[model samples]
Target: MVQQMVQGSVDKMKAELVAYIDKKFEIAALTSDSSGASNTEETEDSDPITLSMIMLQIAAIFEKFGHYDEIYRTYGIEADAFQDECNEVLDLMRYQVEQVESQLKDFQNRLHIEESGGESAVRHNAEMQEKFEILSKDVQESISQFDQYIDTQLKQFEDMPQLLERLQQELASKQGKSESLVRLQEHKSEMIAKIKAAVEELNLQLPKVVSAQIEKALKD
Candidate 1:
């Protein structure tokens, strides 16, 4: 039994080592290929195997190792252990993807906000002050709503067996993670259509404060 246990450990270690090596190789290859391509015409035919390809190869290797029953049997590795390890790895990969997507969404949100406040100048200080107040209030409300949404998501997904805390940190550091804002960004055209339909509702609801200082400066 001891010998079998030792063998199982060795098999698991071997599989993990191969996976790590593959990852490093892929990173190096991708970096080199991208750098080289940036300096040249870079024909499509000359494309290199990217990080994604490396991940595919890693998956294939794991699959092959999984089918090697003799090694598992020799090492006394239980089927449950194999399943647990695979599930953990899969969950980790999914978390990584989620993090990247979150970051992308954040970048989009910031871009959207900046675009919304373009180069047009407010001519009246009073009007500018009022607009600023309204915008600040709206932004704060959006933030509060997003915080509530994240709390809810955390509560809902917390009990998931495969959830990792590190993944949450990565997602948190992402660029535009405000749930409500991100959702609106995703459905922008639809949201814009809705806004157009309810412009009067918005105008009526928001306060009518003005910034004379800002308006006067713009006029000058």
Candidate 2:
């Protein structure tokens, strides 16, 4: 694309310069054939700019395109490095989410396999959050007083429903954390995509801008 744009700018500007030469000098110093196709050489002729300077100007135009191309390649490398880093972090987060999901599955299996005692022993509804909160606090206190836990040991395990309640609460907490991680990973990926898209847009625009600059230089 850059090649086409540069060639188009050079051809148009060269034609205009040739026409100006033919009109002002009434002679073709820049072209020898009717096709207006010939190589121009340096001469001490009086004009706005020398023929060699025109060739230098064209070389400079090509240099501009090369300069942008180098920067574009660097941008691509930097963007790739950033994406790789984000993927590494995302992989770790995915593993952690998977671990939580696995634990939740284990809790579910344990709940199904371990038969609870008669419902008549404890009448707390497992659906209520308050019941689980009470059980969780009791468990924390039991751990704090582990040395004095003969008194609290029977209290902690007296009801099988308390274990189920604690398991459900833990599962809920893990799921919430995993959901946050999933959202963060998605946002990271979206930002990376946007960055890559911006780089591509810059790549697309560089040639056009360079061509415009080349046209302006040739005109001057």
Candidate 3:
């Protein structure tokens, strides 16, 4: 009876974690959709409030996972095996929080750049692409860590690969949009085509890179 109760609690916690993650993704999709609607103006900056909300949700996930870890320990079920995995996941979550905070700060800086006027728009777009690249790298690293952990702990969670692919696609779309915006400042049509092609190639390569990393993680 005690074992059954413990198992029930564990299942409940897992369900809650899954629900929370789903909600996080939902919020992210909503944010992207809202941004797409507003981005038609070309003058509006990315919403800091939306980013802050995502960060807050991430923090909550971290905290909830910590609590779940403690509960797992109390149940005395593979707690030792999970210790390193839990620690690594928490570290990744903390790193992601830092990344989100950095993004928020960068967005504010971009706003200031916008206010400065003139060719700053082109410069701003370039900086935005650079920021996205950094963020993409950070996300790839986090996903790699989690992919490894998932392999060892929950092999049934096949959605991770799809999730990673979706994230990479979103990042690529943002990069492409930024590049196009920057190209608007250039008078040479040839240069714009070349730049767009280069960025598109990079975007095509990025998913493969992320996929390779996840595959390597699973193997290790």
Best by lDDT: 3
Q: For residues 184-212, could you state the per-residue lDDT of candidate 3 as single tens digits?
A: 43424544565576567555755776777
Q: Where is model 2 poorest over a 10-residue stretch in terms of lDDT?
A: 36-45
Candidate 1 at 186: error in angstroms? 84
Residue pairs with colliding backbones in model 2 are none
Model 2: residues >4 Å from true position, as ranges? 1-64, 114-220
Predict model 3's lDDT versus the native.
Answer: 0.63
Better of 1 and 2 by lDDT: 1
Q: Pick the candidate with the highest TM-score.
A: 2
Q: What tens digits encode model 2's per-residue C-alpha lDDT throughout 38-75?
A: 22332224344457855765676667656656655767
- Which regions of candidate 3 are displaced past 4 Å? 1-77, 118-220
Across 85-180, the per-residue lDDT of candidate 1 in tens digits comes to 999999999999999999999999998886676554334556688877876665566556555654654464454333334345545666766864
